[model samples]
Target: MGLNHINLVVKEVDQAVSLFADYFGFSLITNRNSKMAVLERSHQFVLVIWGQELNRKDEIPEYPENFHIGFYQEDEGAVREIYNRLKEVEGLKLDSEPKKIRNTFGFYFYFEKLMIEISVNPFKENIA
Candidate 1:
């Protein structure tokens, strides 16, 4: 079987669900108040967003440096398109403009507590 769902713990489930819906076209499958949500995209990819609750304040979760979720576009232009779209979102943190990184053209940005990377295809050769 192919890959299944990905679960992310975030500070705000409502905001996170909205972000995915607005930017990635994911639709909400279900929501448990503001505490959690299940989102689906492409009919196969499932994303779960979990929010902090009062009782769970003692536990701390951390991601390693450079840890991020990446979205790959077909080419450099598509990557730039998403870059521009995200730039218009007020309060979203964009680390930098899209630039050549290793073999891909992309940029890094953050939404709330999550780090995100957007890149063009990294396997192909001679792509600008």
Candidate 2:
């Protein structure tokens, strides 16, 4: 079976919701007083963001160093388009410009404590 959804716990649920909605084309499905939100893309991928309360400790969740969420683009140009758009957003810091990474063309950035990767698959033909 394929993956269904992903849940992320962050310090600010509303901010994370906005980032996903405004940039990644995820539409808000439900929002619970800024403490949690459910969003879905046109392809049915669901992303759930939860505030610190979800942990029951009121502490901000920390992700492992290499842990990140990735978004695949159709081509290098699409990857660059997203990179350029994110650059115009004040306060958002991109790790670097889109470039060759392993066999893919992409870049990485952080929104709050979550790392995000936007890339174009170089081995697209290899996948079914």
Measured by TM-score, the strongest candidate is 2
On the 0 to 100 scale, the lDDT of residue 40 in model 2 is: 95
Model 2, clash count?
A: 0
- Give the CA lDDT, 0 to 100, for residue 68 in model 1: 87
Scored by CA lDDT, what does every candidate get?
A: 0.84, 0.88
lDDT of 1 by residue, 23-53 (tens): 8889999999888899999998999987766
Question: What is candidate 2's lDDT per residue for 65-94, written digit by digit as tens?
Answer: 899999999999999999989998765679
Clashing pairs for model 1 are none
Q: In model 2, which runs have C-alpha deviations exceeding 4 angstroms?
A: 56-59
Count of backbone clashes, every candidate in sequence: 0, 0
Scored against the true structure, residue 72 in model 1 reaches a CA lDDT of 83
- Candidate 1 whole-model C-alpha lDDT, 0 to 1: 0.84
- lDDT, candidate 2, at 39: 95
